[model samples]
Every structure is written in structure tokens, then in C-alpha cells.
Target: MLIDEMLHLFYPRVCTGCHSLLAPKERGICPECIASFDAFSDADAAGYAVKEVFRRNYPASNQPESAWTLYRFHKNDRLQRVVHAMKYEGVHRLGNVFGTLLAEMIAGSTAAAAFSCIVPVPLNRLKVVERTYNQSEVIARAVAGVLRKDVCTDLVVCKNHTRPQAGLSLRERHSNVKDAFTPSGNVVPENILLVDDVLTTGSTATAVMRALESAGARQISLATVVLAA
Candidate 1:
């Protein structure tokens, strides 16, 4: 304990959100910063507002029946700082923290009981090569641990590197990710909980879910750490 304290004196850690010096037990963002995040659902549950997200962005036939996102992501906010740190700044552990928080909100929900397995949305090969990790996979693993469900990491994969969906129109976004993902094998899943870092237009998620459906995924639900408006 003394040695750890001395090392911290020389090299202090800081919160990602506020950039304040961190206590030993604290991880990426401080508790206050997490509390300050704007939530889509105020009821402290993994609310169903993402259902509307799916309805608005996805084709009626391809819409994800249910979905959940932890934080409402906005520009230049604490949640954004946390996301940038997790996604780009190499603070990979933040994904686990957010996933755990998400699981807490989802533990007793219908989605928790309905999902037979968890599958993280696969990352582009280039991003994985650059980051050396998949943030969504880390999030899925943590969620699976809490939910006591199996995680299927090998079933779905990106078949092509699609263009970035940022700044694209809804039609363009759908066209970009279409046919980008495909199932890897014939094994079927009863109910899949698809996990990802963030949700924007739902185009990417829709494409992946369609692939899973083609591969015999019975019913698919979406889970994300952040929802970008």
C-alpha cells in the first residue's frame, strides 16, 4: 500500500471527463461526471426510447424490435470526453466500466431475460489494427458477465471495410454499410443482444442485425454505451 501511494505521488492519474486528479480506486471518469451525463430515459432503467431510434433510422422491415443506450451523447460534454478516451485515447478499461453500468440498469429487464447471448458489433480491421482492441467487445464481455449470458464473438464479422457513416445522409448511411457484414458460420442463436459503443443513424446496426437474421438469429436486440443525436 505504501509503495503504491508513493508511485501515485510521482505519477498521478486523472479523470477523463473533468481531468481532475484521480483517487486510487477511481478508473477513467469520476463519479460526478458519470452522474452528470444526460440519460435518454430518466427512470434509471435501460429505457425503450431506442425503439424510436430504431424505427426512425431503419427500414420498417429491418427495424430492431428493441434497443437500449446508456447515455445521450452530445458534443463537448463529459460523456463525449469519456467516449473519446475510451475509443481513441487508449483508455480501454472505460468500456468495461460503462458496460457494467449498463448491465446494472438492464439486469431485471425483459431484454436481460430474453437475450440468449451477447454479440458485439465487429470493428473494422483498420480500426482494430490501429487501436489494438475492440471497445464494443470489451463492453459485451462485461455485460455478459453481469447478465450471466453467453457471448458469441465469432458468429458475425465485417465482410468489407465500409465508408465512414459520419456526415452522411440516412440513405447514404444505409447504402454504405449494406452488405458490409455477414455471418461466419451456420450456428444459430435464439436471441442475440448486439452490443456497440454508440448508436447514431442505426444504419450500421441494422445491417449487422440483418446478417445475423440471415444466419438464423431468432430475435435481435441492440445495446450501446452512447446514443448520438
Candidate 2:
């Protein structure tokens, strides 16, 4: 405890969202910033967004279970900065903080206890070799820990390394990611939760879902730290 106090004295903990010093009881985030972030409340998620996602993916038939996101991705804001920090700067603990908040939302949802396994969006081999870690996997581990579930880190692997998705259109992103992911083997849990850091056009998650379904997954639910606009 004394060492922790001394560390804080030397390097005070700052809120990931607001970049402000946090109080003793507070963690990497402050209470005010937590209250400021918009999450998927019952009313917000009451719409057919999840169902619509399924329908869009499966125009003729039923899709998978509903998807849930933790926060609405505001444009070029503080939350964006925090996400960038975690993804690019190796601030892995930030992923845990984001995952903890998202886990709360997941616990209150219908698919709370339905997922048989959690799988994160896999980083490509070259990128993984460069970054030394996948941020989505870190978040997935944190989420599974909170939910008392198991994580399947080896279920999905990025089969191909492609150009960066920066400034790419939705269609371009889809084309770039074609055949990008493959399951490691023939076995997959009946109900799986595919986790990622953000969701923009649902292209990436949808692609991953298709791959999982091809691998014999019965149901899949999408979860992410942020939902992009």
C-alpha cells in the first residue's frame, strides 16, 4: 500500500477519457467522465438495431444474435484519443478499463450469459509481430474475466496482412478484408461472442461473423468498446 501511494505521488493516475488526475478511489477514469460517456441503455438498445444488423447480413434468412456496443463513437473527441492511445501506443491497461465498462453493459443485456466463448478480432501476423500484442485480445480477456467466461484466443487468426484501413471507404474496407480471417480449426463453440475495439460500418465484424459461421458456429454476438459514427 505504501509503495502504491509512493508511485501515485510520483506519477498520479490520470483519467483515460478526460486526461485529468483521478482521486484515490477512482481508477484510470474519473466518475464525471464515466457519467459523461453515453452507453447503450435499455431505451437506446430497445430499437431493432441488432435485429436490423442480422437482417442486413442475412437478407433472406435469420441472422445471429443481437450485437451490443458500449459507447457511441463521437467524432475526433477525447474518447477517440484514449482508444488511439491503447491501439497504437501499447497502453494495454486502457483496453481493460474499456472492457470493464462494456462488460457491465453486456451483463445487463439478453445475451449476457449466452456466449459459450469469447473471441477477439485477430491482429495480422506481421502486425502482431510488430505490435507484440493485440489490443482486442486484451479487451476480450478483460471482458471474459469480468463475465466469468472463457476466452478462445486461438479460434480466429488473421490469414492475410493487408494495407492499413485508414481513409478507406466502407466498400474498400470490405474488399481489403476479404479472406482476411480464418478459424484455426474445425471446432467452434455453439454460441460465440466476437469482440473488437470499435465498430464503424459493421463490415469487419460481419466479415468475421461469416468466417465463424462457416466454421460451424451456431450463433454469434458482436461486442465492441466503441461504435463509430
Candidate 3:
């Protein structure tokens, strides 16, 4: 506890969106960035980019349903930094901040009660060993805690350590992730919430959804902290 205080004192938490130190009652992003983020919320442009992936993969009847996101990912923008810090810089606490916002969104959705379990998009075994944690699981645990839902961190496993999906075309991304995830034979409940830190091309989520479908999960919904618009 004492060490934590000293760290915060020396490194006052800065808003990832604005790089400004947070004020009382403010967090991860500042007021100005919050306002700037609102313009990207058009459901088709920001939220349903995931749906677009589904359009390509399956007919409308076969596509999985999805939920929206909280913010947009601007390349070189503060939201990008926010995701970077959480994923690569050891700033894991932001998962709670992101997860709280996520839970609030989930609470208002019709599928809220349908969710019987929370499962994070899994990280590769090598990456997990290197990072010492999975950012998706961190966020999922926090969201599950707030909603009083069970988390199945060990249910889905990333068996292969492949290249990072960034800068890859959607086709390449889809090819790279094929069969990357497998379930551990856990009986997936009827409804499961799939959590991730970012939704870029939605290929990862789509792949995970297919794996869950094979495992017999009837419904799946995707949630993320930021969506690349």
C-alpha cells in the first residue's frame, strides 16, 4: 500500500485521452477528449464494424449478435495510448475503469440477463508468459465482479502464438486467427459475454464466436473498451 502511494505521488495518473493529469472526479480520459469521442458513436460506423465482419463471413441469419463500444480508436490519438498503456505498459488498473464503463453498458442491454458467464478473448501462451497477465481477462474479471457474473478465464485457450494483427488487412487478419482458439471442454452456459480490450477488424471476436458456437454456446455478444472506427 505504501509503495502504491509513492508511485502515484511520483507519477500522477494522467488521462490517456488528453495526457493531462486527472482532476478530482475525472479519470483515464479528460472532459475535452470525452466530448471529442462523442462524434464517433454512429452505430454503423463505430459499433457495427463488428457486424460488417459478420456480413462477409456469414449470411444475416448466421451472423452472431453484438453490442456497441464506449469510444473510438484514433491512430496516434489518446485513446490509442490508453489501450497501449493497458496492454503493454503495465497499467492494469485501467482495466477496472474500462470494465466499469463496460458493465454500465451491459446493464442497459436486453441481453444483460441472458449472460450466464464472462469469458475474455484469450492471449497466446507465449504472450501470457511474457506479459505475466492477460489484459482481456483483467477487464473481464472487473466487469464480472461488478455484474456478479461468473468468469471463465480458463475455458478458452489461445494455443498458438501468432503475429500481432495490427496493420494486417482484414483478409490477412482472418487467415491468421483461424482455429487459434479452442475451448477446454467446459459446458458453456446458454449466453456468454466475450470481452476484449479493442475491436479493430472484429476478426478475433468472430473467430472466438465460431469456437464458442462449436462448443454449443447459444448466444454471444462482443464488448470492448475502444473500437477502431
Candidate 4:
């Protein structure tokens, strides 16, 4: 504890969202910035937006039993800043923090106690080299810690590099991610939760889901930190 305090004195913790110095109790983020996030409750408009994305994009036959996201991701907004920091600014621990919180939500939802394993949407080899880590895997591991489930990093692999899904039309996004992922090896679980940083058009998640299904996964659900609004 003394060493932590000493480190804080030299390099104080800062909120990923607002870049404000954090108090002692705060770790990666300050309370004010955390409170400012537009959380997605089941009744909220943004929550429904996520469902719409799945409805429009995910195949009916392969639809997940449940899905949940923590925040509404608006461009240039507080959530966007938080995501940017986690993805590009090397605030990697933010993924674990958000994932732990997401696990709490999942524990209370219809999807509670359903997953046997957590599978993060994998990054292609090139992107992994650039990012140095798959942000989704970081989140998935934290979630697994809370849920007591194993994180299957090798089950699904993103073999093909694709263009970024951002700024693309729904059709283009689908085309970009199609056949980009493949399931490898054995050890398929009966139920698994797919983890990702955000849900946009659902194209990427859908592709991942299809690969899991093809690999003999019987039940698959999804959890993410933000749903694009």
C-alpha cells in the first residue's frame, strides 16, 4: 500500500473518460467521469438500439439468447473518449475494469449463469502486432475472473485481416468481415459468451458467432462495453 501511494504521488491516476486526476479510492477512472457515462439499462433507448443491430444483422437461426452493453457510444462523447483511451492510448486496464462491471450486469440479467466460457473476438495477426494486445481478450479475461469461466483465446481466430468497420455502410461492413474469422482445434463448449469492445452494425460479432456455431458451439451470447448510438 505504501509503494502504491508513493507511485501515485509521482504519477497520479487519471480518468480515462475526462482525463481528470483520480482520488485514492479510484483506480483507472475518477467517480465523476464514470458517473457521466450513458449506461445502457434494459429499458433505455440505447439498449434497444443494440437489439436492433442484432435483429437487422445477426442471422435469426444463430441469434444469441441474450446480449448486453454498458454504454451508448456517441462520436466525440464521453464514452467515445473512454473507448479511445482503452483502444489507442494504452489504457489497457480500462478493459478489465469495464469487463468486471459488465460481468455484474450479466450476473443480474436473463443471461445470468448461462455461459460456460468466454471467447473474445480475436484481432487479426497484423492488427494484434500493431496493437500489441487484443483489447477484447483483456476484457474477456477480467470477465472470466468474475464469472469463474475460462477464457478461450484459441477457439476462434481472426485469420483474415479486414478494413476497419467504422464509417462503412452496413453492406460494406458485412462484406469486409465475411470469412475473416475461423474456428480452430477442438474443445468447443456448450455455451459461450462473445466479448467485444463495442457493437456497431453487429457485422463483426455476427461473423465471429457464425464461426463459433460452425465449430459446434450450441449456445452463444454476447457482451460488450458499448453499443454505438
TM-scores of all predicted structures: 0.91, 0.88, 0.85, 0.93
List, in order, the clash count of every candidate structure. Answer: 0, 0, 0, 0
For residues 1-229, could you state the per-residue lDDT of candidate 4 as single tens digits? 8888888899888777777888766767777777888886552344466667887776464776577788887678887878877886678878988999888877776665778889999999898888888899999999889988888988988888899888999999989998999888767887899999988888998899888898899988888888883
Cα lDDT tens digits for candidate 3, 67-123 = 657776677866677688889876777787778877876776677777889989999
Tens-digit lDDT string for candidate 2 (1-229): 7777778888898888787898765666777776777666752472245546546644654354767677776778777777888888777878888788777777777776888999998888899878888999999998999999999877777888877776788778778886798878858888998888977656677778878888889888777877674
Flag the better candidate by TM-score, 1 or 4: 4
Candidate 3, backbone clash total: 0
Task: Give residue 32's lDDT in candidate 2 (0 to 100).
Answer: 78
Clashing residue pairs in candidate 4 (N, C-alpha, C atoms within 3 angstroms) = none
Model 4 TM-score (2 dp): 0.93
Off by over 4 Å in 4: 42-49, 59-61
Q: Which candidate order results from sorting by lDDT in descending order?
A: 4, 1, 2, 3
Q: For model 2, how big is the CA root-mean-square deviation?
A: 2.5
Largest lDDT belongs to which candidate? Answer: 4
> 2 or 4: which has the higher lDDT?
4
For model 1, how does the per-residue alpha-carbon lDDT over 89-168 read when each residue is reduced to its tens digit?
Answer: 78876988988988877785766788879999998888788888889999999999999998888888887878777789
| Shift in Å, residue 153, candidate 3 | 1.1
Q: All predictions: root-mean-square deviation over Cα? A: 2.2, 2.5, 3.0, 1.9
Model 2 worst lDDT window (10 residues)? 42-51
- lDDT agreement with native, every candidate: 0.82, 0.77, 0.76, 0.82
